[model samples]
Target: MQEAAGAAGEISEFAGPSEEEELQRQARAVAQPDETEALNWTMKKFRFPLERLLNYRRSRLAGEQARLEKLLAEQAGLEQRRAALEREERMVNESLRRLPVISSEQLAAIASFRRFAASEAVRLAAEIHAAAGRVAAQRDAVLSARREVEVLEKLRERRLHDWRREVDQETERQTAELVVARWALSRESG
Candidate 1:
């Protein structure tokens, strides 16, 4: 339960400031008209505070994907090697069947080759199994890393959206103020 709470806390921290916090900040700004006047109603650039963390997560995800690619390559190589071994074994068997008057020495040599091929086949099978296992584990690791990156990306997108909304509201407020000032000026001068 403690671990779950800790995880939740971590996720919330990544989620950026709460709406209440944003409202409090806006209230403070409204209470201080001097600060707003000094800025001339220019919108500040949107900057995500956790940009570095997001970059780090993206790099980690890239590394995990690279590892997965390497594991897959290794698995493919093992499979190709096993296929080559099977082809050689089939060729040897075909040659033996064609030999009608084979001498004892030839028979012994053929048997030795067959035994070696069988042992090698077993070894290759074991290697292929191990390689497949490694590939599967690496795939899982890549998936985990991808998920982390996606979470951060989603948070970043959400924050950007909020910033845009705030900018729009500020723009509307400034427009209304300007329209009111223009109307008052026309009424007095006319």
Candidate 2:
């Protein structure tokens, strides 16, 4: 267990979000207004290097989500238009089927109207298809942004835990050394 702990400490040093890095991160936070406010108000006692990255990632994720929502809204509009066009086409086709033996000019006018409705329906269907594709792509982008933020957050948590462990281990080591030295001094005096 002791060997494992020592090895873990050594690994943490190499994998470092080291104490100096944490201090530098806090120092840099002085330049950011948001960070300064959070520093002043929050319960957090220290800053980590990943804090800046996390903030940037969070903003990026928000932007991605907003983009996705906009694309979805546009897609919904296209879908509504397509449905309306299809309904109009059906109504026109039904009217043409019922109006038997009308004047040649009247029949030609109804046929022209039906053709226009079909053309519009085709155009809207194409637009809806393209908009659906864009929405899918935007959704993927949102998911990617979320994944990036989540990874950074998890990394920050791990680094914080390692830092705390390092601090506790150092405190324990110092206390043990002090106790051993005191024991030696008392034994020699005795």
Candidate 3:
């Protein structure tokens, strides 16, 4: 009986493998299974790489958004400058408009033969005519400058509109690319 009990103790101590070891072996078997075997998995199972791709896309989108914001800021500044210039031009035009109109009768009287015999009168008339000519030339110059300002303002507005449209298009394209990449990555991961 002593010998048999010693033999039983030895049998119990001769463990083949632990439960933990068996489980580890089974896990390895499943992990390295046949490549042709289909895995009943979902996209959620491989979210790490998919999430990384999405983050990259988000970063790219952020850069584009920043660029667009900068463009918008520049456009706003240009518009503000244009507005200030327009205000200044309007003030100048208002001042010009308030000036008295020269009458035909005044011009004819200034050029009349009665003043020809008097050297002083003739000199005064000539001076008055020169002053009128100078005023007319100044008015023309102001009108020409105002027209140029208007043309430049219109060009700026057109360029801003075009830039806005381009930014919007780029944003949309990035969004589409992000969506497509996410879908493709998810499919590949699954």
Candidate 4:
């Protein structure tokens, strides 16, 4: 009976690893991080280098647009004034036609007023033409500024995409490492 009891104790002792020992081994493996994690450390944060330039370009575009609007407003005011002058001139002509007994002095005065109105109309038309040219030039400036900003933004987007791809690769690599580590552990225990 004593020899059988001793043999049973020897068999229990030779039983591979206890449940508690297996749990402890797993804990130790978790504590000892793999070399891959130590090497990778952390990823670089994304940053746009031309952010300030982009902002400046947007602001320049806004300024150019504002100048165009101001020019348009000035041209509109000039047109309105010209329309008022035309209406006044028409009223004057109507009055002259309705007058049946106008003196020579009155006729000369009306002729002088008509000459002044004609000169003023010519000056205003020239100013409107100049304003139109300025507005067209400002529109071109705005378009150029917008294009510059768009180029910078596209570059930024491409850089961001590359950074994301790198991050995803790193994540996949770390996941692969973890899987490999788990597989090694399973082999060792099995």
Candidate 5:
């Protein structure tokens, strides 16, 4: 009976070391940093502020996009008007070309017709010119709005990148601190 008890004690001591070794391995595994910690740090550092900025930028972009769309629509309308005016001008020129050569009496009547046609042509030309101006103005407005949105987007991207970099740097620092703490704890335990 005494021999059996002694043998049991020896086995228990051997088991203890193995149990301790397994515990140490588990501790080492737990001490290793995970990607989740880095992601958490980034979110904590940047998400709130970035969200605020993003909201403001989104609102501004929405407004600008709407304005640009409206301007483009106006430009399309103006272009259609200008095209119609050009077609009318072409038809008028063709009619003038096809008209018969006139005698003196016919000349007076033809002169009055020519004068009236010239006045109509001038009026159509003015309308076309005005439509062209409006189209150009609307196009420029849309372009300007687009440029503004692009600039804001670039700024937002830069801000997000800066925030991400800061979070990454902080995560690296925390990881180093965690490693040192784990090393000290292990040494103390040993």
Candidate 6:
């Protein structure tokens, strides 16, 4: 937040007052969901130089999160596949155990089926490992993007807070000036 403020302040050294209508409009825009915090009567236009960057970071965060979800879905698919493979392997083994080894041909076929099931189990394990790695990578990306968005949001809130403070000070100064002017008029009339 401080970084954002410094960047904005450096970009525009010549600070000036905004029009009343513009200030009121921005104040109204900020009022939504924060009626209590925004009850400062008015607020100045809180412009941040890094608004575009903040928006881009937010978008990137969404994209990263989506990718993480996709990776998780893939992992779930791999788990389902492994479970199905285990069921098939168990069914084949049970059938073989129940069947008598009467013919050499039958024994050879059973051995081949067992080998095939083992190979399939190995392949599935490899796929699961790969999916886990991808999911971990995507999760890291999502976390980094989330942090970026958080920082930007905090900066925006800080800028708004500062703007409200400025508006309050300005309002106070104007009120004092009015009071002094009225006193002078009364003195002159008397």
Best by TM-score: 1
For candidate 4, write residues 101-129 as lDDT tens digits: 99999989999999999999999999989
Worst 10 residues of 2 by lDDT: 24-33
Model 6, span 1-190: residue lDDT tens: 9999999997665555557546544444443325664465455577988899999998999999888898899899989988998898789778878877648987788788888888988998999999999999998899999998999899898988888888889879856755665565555446
Model 2 Cα lDDT, one tens digit per residue, 128-169: 889889889988988999999999989889888987887778
> In model 5, what are the clashing residue pairs, if there are any?
none
Task: Sort every candidate by TM-score, greatest first.
Answer: 1, 4, 6, 2, 5, 3
Listed per candidate, the RMSD to the true structure in angstroms reads: 20.1, 18.4, 20.2, 8.4, 8.9, 18.1
Q: TM-score for model 4?
A: 0.73
Q: For model 1, how does the per-residue alpha-carbon lDDT over 1-190 read when each residue is reduced to its tens digit?
A: 9999999999999998898667555544444446657577778999999999999999999999988898889889888988998898889888888988889998899889889888988998999899888888888988898999899999999999999999999889877765665565555447
Q: Give me the overall lDDT of model 5.
A: 0.68
Question: Worst ten-residue run, lDDT, model 5?
Answer: 41-50
Candidate 5 regions with alpha-carbon error over 4 angstroms: 1-42, 45-116
lDDT, ranked from best to worst: 4, 1, 6, 2, 5, 3
Residue 151 lDDT in model 6? 92
lDDT per residue, candidate 5, 82-107, as tens digits? 56656765775677688786468756
| Better-scoring candidate (TM-score), 3 or 4 | 4
- What are the lDDT scores of the predictions, listed in order? 0.84, 0.77, 0.55, 0.85, 0.68, 0.79
- Best lDDT goes to which candidate? 4
Model 3 deviation from native, Cα RMSD in Å:
20.2
Off by over 4 Å in 1: 1-39
Clashing residue pairs for model 4: none
TM-score-wise, the better of 2 and 4 is: 4
